[model samples]
Target: MADTITLEVARYRPDRETEPTVEAFEVPLRRDWAVLDGLNHVKDNLDGSLSYRWSCRMGICGSCGMTVNGEPRLTCATFLVDYAPGPVRVEPLANFPVIRDLVVDIGDFMRKLPEVSPWIVRGEGTSVEEGEYLQTPEQLADYSQFSMCINCMLCYSACPVYGLDPEFVGPAAIALAQRYNLDSRDEGADVRMDLLIHPEGIWGCTFVGECTRACPKGVDPAGAIQRYKLTAALQSLKSFVLPRGPR
Candidate 1:
């Protein structure tokens, strides 16, 4: 129960420094304040030059994700008081190029997201006039858990596979693809199969399960990837056994 705590924040200025460096700043350690709040204090009161991304202070925006003490977490959800009477390390997310202090480039994730077509694709003749697609409770349950992903990129930070192989589609995107794939109203599953089955797709996952562990929203990307693997394997077997013509 100390009055203040030291935050060792990472600083990187492309114009000046070739690598990142840590800078310490002491901020009030209120029980109600979160790690994000401490960063805000540093930016507002101490140094305006510090840079990071944040919005909606609530965890829903998922923009405040950072490496807090070597763990990927939503800064808004991580209470500052939990670190107790000492210094806490804050840095940009791992496995991504640091744009600045505690801010990493997310261009890679944005580019890969569309490859899976995370949406509901229906038949060409299907029209809105046909009425909205209705779903039962059971149907909704199939993909409900995956739908919680807020695209925080914490999964990417925690994924060692992505660190080793940046070409991998990563976890959140794959999980989102599965979310729509499981939707009863969606017909894009077949279209996305090629991407998911690619070497950089679901196959890239080694089932380390760090992505699921880092998710604040309870979206289990590892589970989704594993499930997709089984489905893909079965489809491959069926294609091998069945004739090329329509069955």
Candidate 2:
């Protein structure tokens, strides 16, 4: 590998223009450097004007998600060696309003999160002091995969449905809602049903499956949404038959 490389980063100054532009920075990159490290090099040594969001250098924080060479990925886990020979393009996650260089506004995702009501709801004695709610391993497995979302919004960046309808409750948020719904300890499944059946809810997803593919943490948003769809369909059918059934 070369001693250094030129990383082409996409820059968008929302205050200045409606469109995004590209800027390049020559960094002293080693083969072992992660993309976030290269970004820091650009910010610290090469160009102070270059901007991006990052937190924990490890992949857990999920704060440094971006598009590397047109693929949405967590920068902390993506390495420079993967894209050798210089001149790798780095950009903010796509399909969202840009706040500034390499930082897309996450308001849409936040809105969807609220729409899903992502929280555990129980009966009147909701306090933990009441008792420990228990579940079998089989119950945990039902929604275990969906609970791994880090809210990085990379799935939104990969989803075409969000690009088409900004009002749609996105994949990550919906998947999270399903997580709680399937949890044996939580009893708030009926409360979040409206979100699942809304026109701009699960119906918005086109099964593109890009959201799941782009997630670095193996959070399967596509699978979660599909499972929620089936559950909602069965619930709707049951509602027609049982008068006091889950609404």
| lDDT on C-alpha atoms for all candidate structures | 0.94, 0.85
Query: Tens digits of per-residue lDDT for model 1 on 1-247?
Result: 7899999999999999999999999999999999999999999999999999999999999899999999999999999989988699999999999998888999999999999998888876467888878999999999999999999999999999999999999999999999999999998888899888999999989999999999999999999999999999988888889859432
What range of 10 consecutive residues in model 2 has the weakest lDDT sum?
122-131
Model 2 C-alpha lDDT per residue in residues 114-167, reported as the tens digit of each score: 667788777765567866777799998987888888899899999998888888
For each of the candidates, give the backbone clash count: 0, 0
Candidate 1 lands at a TM-score of 0.97
Question: All candidates' TM-scores?
Answer: 0.97, 0.93
Winning model by TM-score: 1
Runs in model 2 deviating more than 4 A are 15-18, 126-130, 242-246
Count: clashes, candidate 1? 0
Tell me how far the alpha carbon of residue 201 in candidate 1 is from the true structure, in angstroms, after superposition: 0.8
